[model samples]
Target: MHRQFADLRARFLARKYRTERGHEFACYGFSRRLGTMVRAIDVVFEKLPPELDTIPDRDTVVDATLMIQAFVLNAFGCLDNLAWIWVCEKPVLNARGKELGPLEVGLGPKRRDVRASFSKEFVAYLEKRQDWVDKHLKGFRDSLAHRIPLYIPPYIVSPRLSKSTTSSKKPVEMPSESLTWGSTTSCRPSSADWASGGLG
Candidate 1:
């Protein structure tokens, strides 16, 4: 949050912070969840190996996986809680015919209510974020929560690569590797693009 916003938030509390208005307190709730996400990630970093190829002990693996799940859930929670901030800023959004919940705020044909409820600029911002979430976060989070739990494979090896590479005693890596570079908007994303913080 910006310093100006922090100052304004204090002013809002001094003036309009009422027990009945749920949104007034939502900013704090959002803050706490964001903090949890950060803490969970830090805990994961401490508990798990930094290198992908280095496996943790079985007990540590279980603990770290739980922390990762916490991190992911809290990230989405922070997003959802922003809707409450909107409700506080624009009370009409929660008025009779336009009640918008946190989960209800999104951009899509099916989410026309969300587009209609927020400003055009806000919807445009949401479009980009939703795309990123769909591509990166949703599948992993959903799978961990609802389907198969997150799996940290010991290693990756395709059948064809295994046959040729395993013949020698040396380790076999790069089962499937392709290197490419172009404008991010035109190219498929790769680790090389994100690790140094470009594509994202």
Candidate 2:
């Protein structure tokens, strides 16, 4: 997957599409990548066993959590880039009649423009979940980008024993163990949510 994405990115860069369309293409590419990552995370999570004894090893849990964090960070970055492109990629004239680039528009104006230009449904969704974006996604992204030590709490699993006439064996009783990722707990959305065109 890494190599495939690298090749795709290389091909994209080689074309050197620097126009407004290019920005849109870039946004599309990033969105696809984000979707892929989300799917991969979902697959990993699904592979986790429901039985405590049948749970995957610690390494697997760590890797899965890391992938989740990666997805969250990438989603935030991709969306931000897309918003910037939508808001500021257009050519603007300055006082001296010079064409201002995207970066020249400044962050504040770019954000306002993005909000104003976005679809009504998208704008409403953002308005409703602004706190989640700021607190969970943005906070996690910042912590990751700055290399801050994050506290990853363990995933507690309590597997319920099934009742079947074929098997009379009692379910093994085991205490829940904390699967540490680091300083932070797992912050993953439901896989079904992604499949239904939610955050992914």
Candidate 3:
């Protein structure tokens, strides 16, 4: 696992950083690498997808947050779950028949079992984080969905119209056959037109 992480880190640095000094690290040290990952995750959360933005089913959100959190925290082997119960100090305890109180001890014979039970506080924390992530993701998605494409209008030139009404010098003479019977234009269509039926 350590070797795999090392290989992945090396590959990430090589691809993203691309520098002459290989030992200086692209972004930061290993811990800083985790920080960088968290920051990236933060951006991912901030730009929530439109589909996942709305308030989702509680169970579904819980499941998704657990999966995402586990991956981000590198909590493989189910150790993260255990850590959530024991390390983060979040667990429910039942001491009905026992002398100790709820916080005194956990369920099962061993302390491990006692630590893994669900706790209200921890569940609340997870819910809050999920809410935050959901809001940002939704906003990001909305922005993307409503974004418009850019376009540049083509240049156009229109013929200028003449405003003068007075004749300049003598009007040019027109051929006798060029003028129609009741029209001043030469190209006049008569009743023998091809568009009689109209073009649909």
Candidate 4:
């Protein structure tokens, strides 16, 4: 990975991007939230079965589904943090014309100052993108958070199944099979590995 952040920070934008009392280094928040989303995605990928016919392990599948939800939440968090960067940079205002207080902060319609600070094209682009994110990421995360969690069926109906069987409410039963060691175990990194601050 590019590890030149310190070098870059020392060279450029350090003085220019200094935060005011209410402002912050929102880019750091964006990066941290993005990192969280990436880790969630990595775990979700790990839980994914190598084949459609792989053993349907309930625990692993459930963990993977939850991680997927986590990824969506964190992904939206990335956008929220990014929105703060623009708001802080332009120093937006409220109706009273006071520097906008930290209130609802996200890539949503509420952050009107953030939208107004940008060019028309950029604002339009953000609106469309926010719509997409709201539909895809926010809806899923909201459902998982407030309504219902994702449900991974106990069985994965193989795509190789006959059309008739796949069309039916019940998939044709398959024989049970042994799985690899990784399949039977949790996908989480060990505490020691996490303590090392490395991708063990």
The 0-to-1 C-alpha lDDT of every candidate, in the order given, reads 0.53, 0.52, 0.34, 0.56
The candidate, 1 or 2, that scores higher on lDDT is: 1
Candidate 3 local accuracy as lDDT?
0.34
TM-score, model 3 to reference: 0.18
Per-residue CA lDDT of model 1 for 120-172, tens digit only, reads 78777877676677556654555555556654333345556657776888875
Report the lDDT of model 3 for residue 86. Answer: 42
Q: Residue 26 in candidate 2 has what lDDT?
A: 66
lDDT of 4 by residue, 67-137 (tens): 87777666656666666666666666666777655564445656666566778888787766765665566
- Residue 106, candidate 4: alpha-carbon lDDT: 45
CA RMSD of each candidate after superposition: 9.6, 10.2, 28.2, 10.9
Order candidates by lDDT, high to low. Answer: 4, 1, 2, 3
- In model 4, the worst 10-residue window by lDDT is 191-200
Positional deviation of 9 in candidate 4, in angstroms? 12
The deviation in Å at residue 9 for candidate 3 is 16
Candidate 3 local lDDT, 51-94, one digit each (tens): 44233345543443443433333312122222322422332334
At residue 82, candidate 4 shows an lDDT of: 62
Residue 28 displacement in candidate 2 (angstroms): 6.3
